[model samples]
Target: MGHPLLRRRLLLSLPLAAATAGGLGFYILLERARQGTYNPQTFSNPLVGHRVPDFRLVGIDGKHGFGSSQLIASKKPILLNFFASWCVPCAGEAPYLDVISKSGVDIWGIAYQDKAKALAFYLAKYGDPYTRLATDPTGRTAINFGVYGVPESFLIAPGGIVRWHIAGPLVPPIINEQLRPELQKIA
Candidate 1:
């Protein structure tokens, strides 16, 4: 048997060793994140490469509603954006959406649990860039689309196949680097 003092010392050192290893691992992750080489929000979407979920949403603020059939019938790819009037990031992406729309990309906006008046005000404040607008009052449609949160977007190719998805706001970098390249592949 080992000496009692040695055994006690060894047992005490084990916790310190574990703590040191854990701290090192956490530090490495933080460094990677700071270096822009790691994305904590990176995740895979099972819906990608599959058809968009079937849904029928009512129109918001007198805009025409949309359904899966419309997406499937589209002649070209479309960007389906799930946003809310209350979302700050959604507002931040508004200008980019307008620019993208002006560039001839189709964007369909879905308001998630937002009131008509608020949605109208939001659209008025931020230029309306959506070709069509729908309301998911119960957020059931968003649930079906595997939406993690508001301001998510899906790129649906002709026939309603979801080619790509982003779980965050569509900022300039994402639009230029990732979204445009993916659209080119389908185009």
Candidate 2:
């Protein structure tokens, strides 16, 4: 209903306005990232601060396995780790896990979608730090644990409540800065 030239200008301006808004949104996200307040890797799991879900996972050999009862019956805190032989980060964290285990912490490993043979070789090469190992070949146990991917870890308290979780490899910085502090709190 307006003049043709005015109508054309308005239509052209809409795209520019939309693009400007998009740019502004991107800038805000970038600023947040720069400020260290927005980590893209950070995700909230509903399982934190709650009891670990019920699961029965067979070990790599299918004969030796672990269940929810085993975890709940533990007298001390445990680190539940989900890893796969094929994950590079899992390999990277292997040594640190060994160190942590040496410090008297129990680490329970769940091999996610990995073959027994491959896991055996991986442990032989990387050094097995798990006090107990189980296999989650179908990843069902991981789903119950709310694991997003391999190399995720949950700190379970004496009674099997998941007090903390980290969705990455347990590198030195994480060991010293985050995991150690959490361990002290429970101790």
Candidate 3:
């Protein structure tokens, strides 16, 4: 048997270990809160009201795809979305995106930080609503668009100007009320 003092010390250490664990959990929660709340005015590229960045990426069909110039050439408004299979918000917004695409808008999708197979699985399951799907293997295209996370969307005018940007998951109301009107104004 252990000494009585040693037994008491071991018993007391249980509460200390729990307290340490609790403290660590609380600290992690606080850090997450801070990160979530830290929204900056300027995105990486500050694309709003600026010309859309030129990029060429791989399409879902494994073809070389391009943005910006193609939209300008087509003389139509463009909706660009940054998404990834692993992003929950992106999945949440998928149905709304499908609706928008079906409405005849020139919608394009950029798969950010995602593998082709995963992107294919997501599209297969959720239905591909994009007129074109550009794969950004390294997420460099997302950085150009000032994207902090997946499910970020941009409305570009016929002149290739980025008119509006929405972060996070999108809903039908947001699309109809805010995004559609903004696109009309730019168009």
Candidate 4:
């Protein structure tokens, strides 16, 4: 058997080894990004420019539901936002989304892997900006949209085709520079 001191030393090295591995992983990611070859797992949606998948999800309100048609038939451009109550960036981006909704844009919020009670509480806390909110607790719909993370959004044109996709929170610059210009075309 090993000496007791040797066993203790080995045990104590576990955390150091784990930390070194984690640091090395991060450094590799950084170097990859610096080389301009970094494609984040969430960097692009394969569903972009494709027809939205048909899905019928019940709303948190318990009164209505929505599907791809709701997004496709909008007179104005529709923004389909995928979020979860548990997501931090979703919370941070909520207010701006509310503002966008109020500016005559149609927004359909998809609750990815979230429960109804939590969604109600989240909306009550953050403000409900969704024209209609649909629950995707099973993550089936998220897969159809090529969503790997929360706070992703798709701009669907009037003909049911996805125009552009944003795989992050709706910041002001993105809203202005990317979204607004595209919205104008569909307007």
Clashes of each: 0, 0, 0, 0
TM-score of every model versus the real structure: 0.80, 0.79, 0.73, 0.76
* lDDT (Cα, tens digit) per residue for candidate 1, span 42-140: 687799999988898889656579999999999989999999999998998899999999999999999999999999999999989999899999999
lDDT of 3 at 174: 73
Regions of model 2 farther than 4 Å from truth: 1-39
Candidate 4 ranges with C-alpha deviation above 4 Å: 1-41
Model 4: lDDT of residue 79 = 92
Give the total clashing residue pairs for model 4.
Answer: 0
**Model 4's lDDT to the true fold?**
0.86
lDDT to native, each model: 0.90, 0.89, 0.79, 0.86
Clashing pairs in 3: none
Candidate numbers sorted by TM-score from highest down: 1, 2, 4, 3
lDDT of 1 at 66: 93
* Worst 10 contiguous positions by lDDT, candidate 2: 32-41
Q: Which candidate is the best by TM-score?
A: 1
Q: Please report how far candidate 2 places residue 148 from its true position, in Å.
A: 1.4
Off by over 4 Å in 3: 1-45
Question: Which scores better on lDDT, 2 or 4?
Answer: 2
Number of the top candidate by lDDT? 1
